[model samples]
Target chain A: MAVRVQREAFDIGAEIDRLRAGRTSVGAVASFMGVMRDFNDGSGVQSMVLEHYPGMTERALESIVAEAGERWPLIDTLVVHRVGELRPSDPIVLVVTLSAHREAALAACAFIMDFLKTRAPFWKKERTPAGERWVEARASDDRAADRWQEGDGA
Target chain B: METAHGSVRVLYFARLREAFGTSGETMDLAPGLCTVADLRERLALRGGVWAEELAGSRVVRFAVNQTLCPPAHALSAGDEIAVFPPVTGG
Candidate 1:
């Protein structure tokens, strides 16, 4: 597993190759990429600064991936998150690749991303034309993360 | 010496910094402060409306020893505590 908070953007193609690097047993790879949207909570966002509880962020993500791995027999997993200032359309997060099979890879990939969305201790402060404000946590994210508790993926 | 005589360190993040007007601080725990909640009460004793914001039922997050924890987490000497609002980053 890989987790980072940086200003750099990740290349999905290179990441997949690296995950599959030196491995022949992998059959399928599933990935998720999150981007900064132009709008949040009805506010027209111009730029956003991402802040995280540095030590806690890593632990939270590792636990999330570990939970996903326990539910699915994934070959490998990667999570990358961007920190510092970013603009709309810039990549904000990336979750990539798992599997001995497509179903396991796909399901685990989705599950990991969903879990990270809600459980991770990262915050976004959006800068709009009017002023800066912290983005609100969405109920949809909570519901998405909840699906795992019901064992809906399995 | 038991080496337990130093002040308690409080760390802040995200919106909590805005609310507290500072990111991190160290305060002598005194004789009565023992747990995370007690420390919070002492923080409230600092007076003014800032105390009200710190002690209010806002959705603040907590961590002790770099571990995400609750207000009930028992704290010992030299423990690092962090406070922030509910996270909204992906």
Candidate 2:
């Protein structure tokens, strides 16, 4: 498992290939990438700045990935989140490479992203036409995290 | 004829500090406020801008001991409770 918080953009394909480098049991690889958008809550966003609680952010991601490990027969996992300023269409975050059987890889990939959306300790401030405003958590995100409580892989 | 007691220190970060104008503070909490929600009500009573910012059902985030926590999280003297707006960072 790998979790990195940096401003550098990540290459999903490269990371996935490295993860599977000598592993044969891995039959699947799944991933997700989150990018900065130009609109939020009906506001025309120009850019965004992300901030996090340093030590706490890494710990939170570690815990989330550990939970995924417990639920799936994952061979490897990676979570890369960016901080500082980013413009629209910039890759802000990436969770790539879950190795396992095809089914386990896909399910674990979705589960990691869903858990991160609600549990991660990062925040974004968007520069919009009005001004820089903090984005609020969506009800949809809350619901996404909620499903895991009942659907723990059994 | 009284012993000295330290005040409770509450930390603020992100939008909460920007709105409140103070990054952190140690305040002598009034008697009987011993949980996250209780502290919020007492702090909200500070009046003026604070009353407007923290008043009524506004969504705010809480962290106790560096972990995301709910308002129901219990507090004791000297515990570190951080208040901020909901996280949106990548």
Candidate 3:
């Protein structure tokens, strides 16, 4: 498992290849990439700045990935989050989970994304046409994270 | 009981940093200030922007020693405290 928070953009194909190489036990790799949008909250966004607590952000992300490891049968996981200034279409975050089965890989990928959305300490401020404003946490994200607590018994 | 007096390094982020005009400050904890909530109330005594930003209805979150903590969490000398708005990351 690995977690990286950096300003430099990463090559997605290279990241995937690294996971696939020298790993014959891995049967599936599920991934998700989050991108900056051109608009949010009904306003046009020109750019965005992401801020995070350096030491704390890494610890929090490691804990999130560890939690996924405890709950799922996984082979590996990778999380990369970008910081500093970014523009629309810029990738903001990436999650990749590997497992012997597609179900565990897919479910763990979604679980990591859901937990990252709410549990991570990063914050975003968008330069909108109106003005720069800090983005607010959405209730939908809380709801999504809450579902995990309910378990897959449903 | 002996009254406890201590200090903590308080850090701010995002909007809080913009509003406070600084990244962080070392605060001397007043006597009997034993909880995160107590520290928040003491800071709010600064009034104006501090009062408004930390109002009870606000969506501010607190972290003690780099861990997300509730208002009732206890405080300690030399701890690193972080106060900021709710997280909005992917």
Candidate 4:
């Protein structure tokens, strides 16, 4: 398992290749990439700033990946979350899960993302047409995270 | 016995930092001030923004020693406490 919280842009292809290297046992890789959108909540977003709790953020990501490991037969898991200023279309986060079967890889990928959405300490503030505003936590995100608690795998 | 006093490192993030105008501060806690809620009430003594931002209905989250915790969680001397708005990340 590997987790990175950085300001530098990440190359998704390179990261996947690194995980695939020397791993003939891996049959599936599931990945998710989150990008900054040009608009949100009826406003045009100019840019975004992500703030995190530094040490706590890394610990939280590690814990989330660890939880996924316990639930799935994951060969490898990687999470890369970017911090600081970013523009529209910029990659904001990435999650990659490798497993012998598609089911484990796919489920673990979604699980990691679901937990990370609400449990992580990162916060986003968008520079919109009106002014800069902190993005509020969506109710849908809470519901997404809550569903995992009701079941064993998902 | 003397009334005990201890200091905690309080951190503010996101909007809290923007409102408080500082990233963190060292607060001296009085004895018997145990839980996160107690500390918040004490901090609220500053009134105005402090009281308004930390109002009961506001969406605030707390972390004690870098771990997310509830308001009733006990606090300890030399602990690192963080106060921030609800997280919005993916």
DockQ of candidate 1 is 0.64
* Candidate 2 TM-score to native: 0.88
Q: Is candidate 1 or 3 superior in DockQ? A: 3
Q: What is the C-alpha RMSD of each candidate to the true structure, in Å?
A: 3.1, 2.9, 1.7, 1.9
Q: Cα lDDT of all candidates, in order?
A: 0.81, 0.81, 0.91, 0.91
Of candidates 3 and 1, the better by lDDT:
3
Which order, best to worst by DockQ?
Answer: 3, 4, 1, 2
lDDT of 1 by residue, A34-67 (tens): 9999997777999999988787888888988888
Chain A TM-score compared with the true chain A, each model in order? 0.93, 0.94, 0.96, 0.97
Q: Please, what are the lDDT tens digits per residue for candidate 2 over residues A46-131?
A: 99888787777898899989998988888899999998889999988888655657888888888888888877888888899888
Please rank every candidate by TM-score, starting with the best.
3, 4, 1, 2
Candidate 2: misplaced stretches above 4 Å?
Answer: A151-154, B1-8, B28-30
**Residue pairs with backbone atoms closer than 3 Å in model 2 (clashes):** A122-B89, A123-B88, A123-B89, A124-B88, A124-B89
- The native-contact fraction of candidate 2 is 0.52
lDDT per residue for candidate 2 within B1-90, as digits (tens), equals 333345677877677777889989886755557678888888899987677767778887888777888888877667777777766654
Regions of model 1 farther than 4 Å from truth = A151-154, B1-6, B47-49
**What TM-score against the true fold does each predicted structure earn?**
0.88, 0.88, 0.96, 0.95
Task: Highest TM-score: give the candidate number.
Answer: 3
In order, the interface RMSDs are: 1.3, 1.4, 0.7, 0.7
TM-score of chain B of 4: 0.89
- Give me candidate 4's TM-score against the actual structure: 0.95
